[model samples]
Every structure is written in C-alpha cells, then in structure tokens.
Target: MSETLSGQATSTISAVVGRADVLIVGGGLSGAMLAAQLLRLPGRRRILIVEPRAELGRGEAYSATELGHTLNGNAARMSVDPDNADDLTQWLEAFIAKGGWPESDQQHVPVSELFPPRGIFGLYVQQRLAEAREQGAVSGSTAEHVCGEAVDLHIDSSGARLTLADGQCLEGAYAVLATGMFPAARTRQKHSSGLNAAAIDPWDVAAMSRLDPQGTVLIIGSGLTMVDAVVSLEQAGHRGPIRVFSRHGLLPHVRRQPPAWEDFLAADQSIRSPRQLLREVRRQCAAALASGIDWQAPLDTVRAHIGRLWSQASDVQRRQFVRHVRPWWESHHHRSPPLSAELVERLYKEGRLTIEAASLKGLDEPRDGRVSISIRPRGESRARTVTGEALINSTGIEYDWRRVDRPLPQQLLARGLIRPGPLALGIAADPGGAVVDAEGDVSTRLFAMGPPLRGMWWESTAVTDVASQAKALAVRLAQLMDSQKGRG
Candidate 1:
C-alpha cells in the first residue's frame, strides 16, 4: 500500500505502471525537481517517477509536521531554481499574501531570512512541480508518480527495468538514481551496532511524548540532527536533563546573515591541499573578524569551491581532511537555524543540557527500566556506562553505499552496477552523473543525481546543488533520448 504523510495515494492501484522514456528511481525532492526540469524543456517524452510515498515532493527531510522542525538555511539560500535565487523568496511572499503560514509573522524576519518549516517548504516544491506539469501538458511530455518503493533494478540493451516492493515492474529507455540521503536514525546498516534498535527515532515527536517529562534523555551525535532532536524533545514537553555524545561533540554554529566576502578560493587557484585551504581560511576569517565582519562570511565563500578541491585532491589528502578536519567542517558548515540554536543555548545555560566527547562502545541491557549504553571518552581507554529514560540516535546522514542494507543498494552492488565512491562516502559516478560500475565502466542507461553523487561532488545534497544537477541532467537525458529516437 502506498501511504502519504496525510493519507494513502488515491489513484495508483496497479502492479504495472507501464513503460516510459525516462524512469526515475526515487521521487523525493531530487526526482521531483528532475521531473520538473524535464517537463519545462521542449520534449515529448513519457516519464515515470517510482516512489513509495503518496506525495511527490515531501522526501525524508521536508516531511516534518512540527512547527519547531524548520529548515536550517533561510529561504534565500534554499531556492530550487538554479538561475533564479529569489524564486523561493518570491513564492513565500505570494504564499503569505494568499493567507498561508499565518504563523510566519512570528519569525519577525524578512521573507528571505525566514526559516520556514520543512512542511511548508515541501508545499512550495509541490506547487512549483505543479506549474511544471501544466507547462509540460502544453507539450506532448508527461510524468506520473508511481507510488511504490523500488527494490531492484536491471539494465540491458533494450532499456532499464525496476522492480517495486509490491511486485510492480516498470521499464524506461534510461533510468536515473535520484535516491536521496539515508539518515542513520532510520536506515538499516550492514553492521548491526544495536544502537539504532535500542533508541527511538529522533524525528518521531509522538514517541517522545510518551517518555517521562522529567527523566533524562541520552542522545548520540551533536550535529544539526541533534539540534532537531532537542527541538522534538522540547515540543514533546520533556524538561529533564539532555546528555549528548559524539566523538567531537561539536554543536553546529548558528546561521546568520553576513556581508559578502571575497572569494579567496576562486582568486587563489593554488589552494588545493586541505592544510593550505585551512590556513588560508583562517587568515581570511581572522581578517573578517578584525574588520568587524562575521567569520562565517569567509566560510560561506568556500562552499562553491568544495567540489573542485575535493574531486582534485588525492585519496591520501582526502583521508587527512576527513581524519583531522571533518568535525569542525561539519559543525561550521551545516549550521543550525537561529531559533533552534537559541533553544539549545538556553538549555545549556540552564544546566539542562550537556555535551560530552565520547564514542559508543556497546549497548547494554536496560537498567532500572532505563536505556543503557557504554561509551569511551575521547582520550580515555576506560568504558563508562550511561543510562537514560530514553535514547535517540542522531548520528546524521549515512553516505557509505556499502553500509546501507536496502535491497536496491545490495542488488546493485552484487550485480556490479555501482561502486563505492571516493572514501566510501557515496556511490561513484562520472562527472555527468552516469553511474560508474564496479569494473569502472560508465553506465550508458543508468544515471545518478543528488546524494548518490556525493563522491563526485562533496556537496551534492544541498538544494542548489540538486537543482543545478536536475537542470543539467534533464538536458543530458533529453539529448540522449533524441539520439535514440534518431537511431530508431
């Protein structure tokens, strides 16, 4: 059964959704944006979007219903249009004028700076996709959302084929792996750490409400997801102690509007090594601070250059960066929203929340009806036990394709259709988003975008990244389709 956040999908009741010119494996934001881009282009191709959810746009990130669960970045930075940065700002203004998001006024910020709730953002994506559909209708192009989870994929000379969880089968001239990020709290990994099974989902606010309000809550990881878990706990009326554990215990910095800084990386082409880049960034940040500018201004300029630097870096350099710099990079780069940061700060000030630098060693039997775990401190060899009324795993996104225990990933790996990306971050793919097989051969019929290309582009999961990729990949697919037609 295909279920949406609101209800079940109403129209799809078939085991076979038929053939199309293009088959998108996942129908989240990546798939929806890709479909939207394709629909707007001049074409007469039939497209099939295979997804389990009834809704077309609300992926894992934007499906939150809580008011407290908001986007980390403001509207200005989260637009889905690659060419038009103000697309979301304009849409939000019109949406507000239509009497939507009545509570948005409480944010007391400009439309561009407002951190809209994820649910509202999902609606905006759906509306944009609706417009794309209307435009596509004028042409002979069309797309359908097949509400089913894709289990396995097969590629042959004729076409690419997909098998759904509910026994549905689909075919297309070519397929794209728009499979989005897999969050660690909810996904199944090959290595059974037993931590996820012992903990509650970080986003499930309803489950949090059942816990004792005054009991201590133990959390793992201190990144943006940990911030979200705190918001969930607070909204669920939990007021007791909150203890967070991670290797670095680095809390994300609060995102703020900063003045534009010079693009140091762009101007200085020699900044390729991680050490050199870090030193230059420090110098730039120091200069910014001395000039009374926000330090994040310098850091923001580095965002555009990550793909170039990462892709060109040697594997040894990449390892050095990951080993020594990853923690600080994540904490500074993936910042939390101001409101969420304020809540976390207030709780810390009140002595209600604490952070510890440690790593999970093992899970133990429940003690005194409380969840228990063993953790070793950063510089210590002794393992210590920590217990809580409830536990949450907020370790953030899992990018290692081999660790993901899903059927599709496993099948793809076994069939040599895909390979682990650089440093095993995500599946390896070529520059144009074509899937690179186990034998290092580029796939002609299968392509990838969004998080699946993390190895190729270090920052592939962001909104702007996905939008740019969607537009480019859509054009590539269209050209491929035209060539195939000519051959036929």
Candidate 2:
C-alpha cells in the first residue's frame, strides 16, 4: 500500500504521502550525491528526493540520449566522493573488466583517458546512487525517490511543506533546493512575426531529425551547446552547412593534459579582486610557457581557489568581472574534449561549418520553409540577412532566477522565500548552501546547493565543486536533523 503523513488531503490528486528528515527538491547529480553522502553518515534519517524525471542522476546536462554527447572531464576527476578523487577511475576499471562497454567502443579509446558518453556517465551516477540507497537500507536509514515536480514550498515554525505538481504535499524537517541549471530563455525577437515556428531547442534530436538533411542550420551562441548541436547533426547524418554566431565567436579551447604548476596563491591568499588575480595569473602563465609547460597549468591551479576569490571579491568587482572577463574566462576554462574539437575543426576545414562574431538583430518570418535572420557583424554597422531551415538557440544555461520561467522559481520569488544572489547570478545562498530570504535572513528550514549556489561559488557547476558542496551540506543537514530529533 501507500504511506501517509498526518496532513489533510485538500485535493483528489493525493494526500501528504510521507515525512522525511531531509527533502531534496532535485534528483540530478547534485541531489543524488548529497543523498549518497547523507546515507553514508551515521544516522537513520529518511531522505526523500523529488524529481520529475524517471531516473535520479541524469539531469538536463547528462540526460542527452545521443552517443556523441560525452563528458568534458576524464573519469579520474569526475568522482562523486571528493575525498576519493579516483573513485570513478576505479569504478570504471571494474566496469570495463566486467564488460560494461561493448568491445568495439572499448578498443577505440584508452579507458582511463576517455571522455565517456554522457549517457554512460549518467548510468554510473545512477549506479552509485542505487548503491548508496542499498547502504542506507542496511543502516536502517531509508531513501525514497519521489517521481514528481516540486511546484511550491511553504515553511512554518516546525518545518517546510512541498507541493508537487499533481497536488500531492510532502512535509519534511528540512528542504533543499537543488534545482540545477535552467534552460536559456528564448530571446524576445524585436519583430515577432512567424519566427516562432523557426526556433527549436538545440538538444531536441527529434526536431533536428525532422529538418531537411540538406538545409542549412543556423545555431546561435557558439559555445559548448553549439558543439553539442553540431555533433547531434553529424550523428543524424546531416551533411548541410551550419552557421554559428555569437557576440565573441569564441569556441572552447581543446582540453589537454597539463602538468601541475606550483600553487603561488596557496601561501599568500591575499588576492581578492579579479584584476589583481588576473594579473598574477597572466604572470604565472608566461612563466609556465617559458618553462616549457602549457599555460593551462597555471590556470588549472586557480581552480582550487576560485570559490575563495569569488567570495572575497566586492560586489562591484564581481560585476566588473562578469561584464569584462566572463567571455574569455569561459572559453579558456571550460574546454571542449579533444575529439569533439577535432570534429569541429574538420568540419570547418571542409567548409561545412561557419562561425561568425556578430550580434543577432532580429528574426524575420519564415519564407516558404527557411527562416531569415538579420545580424550585424562585429565592428560593422551594416546588417546582413541569412536564411536557414531551422534556428537552434545554444545560448547556454540561464542562471538568473528572476528570468527563469519555471513554476517553482516563480512561486518562490512570489513568496519572497528566496532572493537573487550576487550580481543576480543565481539564487541567494550562504557559503554553507543555506538559502537567504529577501529580508537578508538565513533560512533554517530551507537550503540549496549545485548551480543555484553559483553566486557563492563561481565554479559550482562542475562535479568536483558540486561533490564537495554536497558532502559539506550533507554533514550540516545531518547535524540539524540530529538536533531536531534530540529536541523531539
């Protein structure tokens, strides 16, 4: 049968089904990792992860069904456990030994160095979560996966109540908003004629497949998502030309193995401003290059200190960095896998792909079948028109909560339960992942992690960043639960 909590059922959809010590609002990697960490700790608390997806680990980024979509980082650095950095590498070795991958795929790349498919990584995450769930069962702590979207949240003196889209309610001692990256909002075209029918989601493979194989494709914002779109086209046997446009026309640098450089900032730890930090980084890069090392070595060293640097920077400095340095930093820091870069290079050399630095003016109505795009090339005032069978917006993830069209975020903003973080990057959160309300009060019943904590940690989206945050948040939440139990 079904479990029930001590709350009244207001609708026929369902009653308040159950209660948990910790209620997680997302089931992506961040939520899964947090749940896993909590399960490992000494406790018998119940954890309920509410997610709309059928599986827990495959969030938007890793949920791609395409074989060409692969992880940007290697297995050694992608482990869920921050303490055991090589856990994924070890797991991958055993997986290969047990014939986890097909022989044909295994022979093509070295397992340790391979950028495995996103789908495979998703499976690995699901497997880890499943194992953690089993461990929780053995420890008398229970973790339940609730398949539903959290539409609204209400907090009271005792705890917080979550309302699902289907009208079911769940009450928990504590709630975590682990909602990860939101899709980039559609650009409001100046001339909103028939352009609506021309734009399609970049990741929608079915929609891409429906396009004429020979028709030109116009992709907006040439970054990682643009690469994914190109790969998807190639996988679908698309042979037509592709034109990609963005403000900077910057493509991600190819990922390369770099030796560890000395941590110059580790001892000093005084650099707070982005300008000061960038100056030091440039100096180190030059020194590394002089010493026959890739410049990436010095930049890689900065990864460990990004959170501290971001936290210490003044709001004005932070805004300056976003306005001036974000584009270059993104292109250099978030690199493309070598294989994908090579594919893009090959296509460019063959004249099948064109990348341009330009600003999108507006989209004209679809004439016959193709859509017309008006763009002003960088440094040129004259506008030119280009026609494509379809347009895909690869502008990347939207971080500002205020602009997100999701129901949960909208409701949260309406209730003043959360506020915008620094520079309106994401949801307001403290260093420890606790949500801060509009009145600048720390939330006792509500917390957050993952991408929503980006304002607190500039590099929070990566697995390493998320894993460390998850571990720390899990420990903190466990302590809170213990105190609540003691009071009871």
Best candidate according to TM-score: 1
Task: Show where candidate 2 strays beyond 4 Å.
Answer: 1-16, 103-110, 185-197
**Least well predicted 10-residue stretch by lDDT in candidate 2:** 1-10
Candidate 2 lDDT by residue in tens digits, 1-488: 12222123436433334677889999899998999989888979788888888778888877878767878887776887788888887777777778875642644656667777788788888888888877887878866777788999998778899998877888899999989988562433323343434677666777778788989999888888888888888877788999999999998988887888899889667777888888999999999999899999998888899888888888999988888888988999888877788889999999999999998888876688778899899999999998898898787777888877678988999999999998888888888988999899899999999999888878889888888998999999999888887898
- Model 1: pairs clashing at backbone N, Cα or C within 3 Å: none
Once fitted onto the true fold, the runs of candidate 1 whose alpha carbons sit more than 4 angstroms away are 1-16
Highest lDDT among the candidates is held by which one? 1
